[model samples]
Target: MQFIDLKTQYARIEPELKVRIQAVLEHGQFILGPEVQELEARLAEFVGVRHCIGMSSGTDALLAAMMALEIGRGDEVITTPFTFIATAETIALLGARPVFVDIDPVTYNLDPAKIEAAITGRTRAILPVSLYGQCADMDAINAIAARHRLPVIEDAAQSFGASYRGRRSCALSRIGCTSFFPAKPLGAYGDAGACFTDDDALAQALREIRNHGQDRRYHHLRLGLNARLDTLQAAILLAKMEIFPEEVESRARIGARYTELFQARGALGTDVGGAPVLTPYVHPHNLSVYAQYTLQVEDREAVAAKLGEQGIPTAVHYPIPVSEQPVFHGGLLGADYPVSAAVARRVLSLPMHPYLDEATQERIVAAVAKAAGL
Candidate 1:
């Protein structure tokens, strides 16, 4: 089965998608077109934010957010190491050091307890990633940032549709960013992203930062990049939005079913070599979109191989922590991130999508159970 059944999703929205794309083609305003503005407005409304600045890619969105906050050389941004490279890469790209923090062993997100200890005089901002489609503890993180008088940027790339408490993912912090990569919960056909904020100044700054720092044509207010989201992608996303709420519900249902099936098969706490096979630990206050239904198992490679033999596809969300990446020179500035190190070796993702069916899910879980020797 496909890891993410985009083909099925496309078929469901085909007619509306065609109409939206056709309008974009007919209008011919490819860059920052009408569709882009409309999509931005809708997304902002969905997230309960004042502004949503569409970007060319999630990476650029992070970069623009940092730029808007004036993060640069000699500055430090506190963040977790157990996330996609883009989380820390953008910080480093801006000549800012990414101070690594360990993750909560249960949620595999930045451990708020460790965040305060990492802050120093040079700390410019706090960035927390919502990994595996669930939000990090934004309330705690925001409190810490408030104490430090720093901005908090929530990297909601994997959790655009998720909810923390009663608020949406992209509306929980000073600046929130999310990706529209094809595999995300609310993905577009191609690369796209957005930055959301309630601060009008930061919103305007983000909009300018994504468009060569121009407030208007030929007016360069600050240095920026050509990171505006394509009109076609916005059109496609707008069409996708029509059914996104339903898809979010499906994802939550499917995720719960996967956990329920694994537990019923006696695979929840079963030992897989050294480590026990563990399901994702979502916090009670958060509603995850379940972008990837991941598990922690010992001998991950062996487990993945066993699943593959049964014609089931599996993936590793991340095999290496950013702190251990070669570019970071092996734990940059010589800090220890034991939790990130451990999680990196055990995390494995299985097929997850809103369209996944019960029978297919049973087959996948049975494969996992057998693979784990349960």
Candidate 2:
């Protein structure tokens, strides 16, 4: 019944987490501790990247990557609007324009066909978000970037463990960033994030940027922010990493089961398959970590209310497109971003986690079916 069973996950890793934390306490290197480097190393290896620079949060990771890339005023970063605000906020923060692109209705990711048209002479990078744990069309995006000689920054906040065409999410672009927010698929106990890249110079620049642009002790190389990941969070992430692979596999299994159940009901035109509900889509060359088991449902507010009445928790990943947000109002208007607008009105997320039990899942499905009046 819980939306994301963190308690069960905590129970599973309690002993290891305790031990990891105790080690951090004993070491007493609270900031930029050995544990942080250890975590970065493990994460980099996992992602098949040459370097991973840990930071305070995913937003900071994005900002740091932009800073390292020298993205500045008048520079434009093309991205989809059907995602969390952080994806666009970071670009705006650097005084760069976030060129909004429509999404693929089925995948809820940036539509590559729509990307080239958004590109202008000011375009410096392609910032594609891997929404809800599935990667966008990286190959297509990369092809466009290559043609323009632009860097690609993969906003992998919700897709830490996802794979695209045999490559990991965070290792697919010039620089990739992911969050360790507790709600993310692969998360630490608190705010933490990492930037991944194979380019040594960019990696070096990111390390300096995360540490206030210091090339050496007190020698400021460039303007930067104090974005270092804390020792405690690093320890927690290390503990979580021990079992993350298994958890990802478990999540895939759960997703497959949900797909089977929903597709069966959908084919039968049952309540769950009624006009209100549309299942998520997974690409053939990619694997989703199922960070959010989302559905496209009609009258989302009413469906959510009905599910709430049944004691089944449901939430929206995003209710408004980032382009329409108050902060970015009118910035992307007249862009004809039809798919992003449509997705914002309909997306609903159900309880999803590796620890989700079968009985609880069935109850959730039943409640949804009844709510949809299938």
Candidate 3:
């Protein structure tokens, strides 16, 4: 089976998608066209934010947010090391440091309790990644940021429809960034993303930053990158948005069902090679869009091989911690992040998508159970 099954999703939205693309082609306003503004407005409204700046990619979205905040040379940005490279790459690109923090073993998110100790005079921002479609402890993170008088940027690349304490992911922080990479819950045909905020000044700065720091046509204000989202991607996203709300609901439901199926076969706390198979944990009052329903299992390689033999595709969201990356040269590895290190070894992401069928899910779960020797 296809890992994400985007073909089915495309088939469902084909008619509307074609129409949207046709309209964009006819308008001939390819860059930052009317559809882009409409998309920005709709996305902002959905996130309950005052402004949404469409960007070239999720990486650029983070870069723009950092530029708007003036997080630059010699500054340090606190974040977890157990996420995608872009989460830390953006900080380093701005000539800043990415301070690594350990993750919560259960949720696999940056543990808020460990954040305060990482802050120092050089700390400029707290970038928390909402890994696996679930938001980090934003309430605690925000409170800590407020106490330190620092801005919080939610690297919401994996979470667009997720919610924490009744608020959306992009609206939970001072600046929020999300990706529209084809695999994301809401994605464009090509690379695209957005930065969201309620702060007018930051919003305006981000807008300028996305267009070579332009104040108006042909006017450059500050050193900025050309990070604007193309109109074709905007139109495609607008079309995808038509069914995004329902798709979000379907994903959550499918996630819950996966948990139930696993539990029935003795997943959690079930002995597999003298170790328990740990399922993902959703914090109370938090609603995840369930981008990747991952599990912590022993003998991950063996289990993955078996799953592959059964025609079930599995992936590891992150196999290496950013701290251990070659470029970091183990500079951030002085302190042991046992949880991040351990999770990296055991985590396996099963096929997950909003349109996943129950029968297919059952087959996939059964294969995993057999592989785990349950």
Candidate 1 residues 1-374, lDDT tens each?
Answer: 89999999999999999999999889899998999999999999999998999999999999999999999999999998999999999999999999999988888889999999889999999999999999999999999999989999999999999999989999999999999999999998889999999999999999899989999999999999999999999999999999999999999899989988988887664342434448876767889999899988889999999899888999998999988888999446458889889889999999999999999999999888888887
Listed in order, each prediction's TM-score against the native is 0.97, 0.96, 0.97
Error of 3 at 275 (Å): 10
Q: What's the count of clashing pairs in each model shown?
A: 0, 1, 0
Residue 152's C-alpha lDDT in candidate 1? 97
| lDDT string, candidate 2, 265-374, tens digits | 65232232223337777877888999999987778899899999888888898988888888997764447677778878888899999988788888877777777665
How far does residue 174 in candidate 1 sit from its true spot (Å)? 0.1
lDDT of 3: 0.92
lDDT to native, each model? 0.92, 0.89, 0.92
Give the CA lDDT, 0 to 100, for residue 148 in model 3: 99
Off by over 4 Å in 2: 267-277, 332-334
lDDT of 2: 0.89
Candidate with the larger TM-score of 2 and 3? 3
* Reference-based lDDT, residue 325, model 1: 88
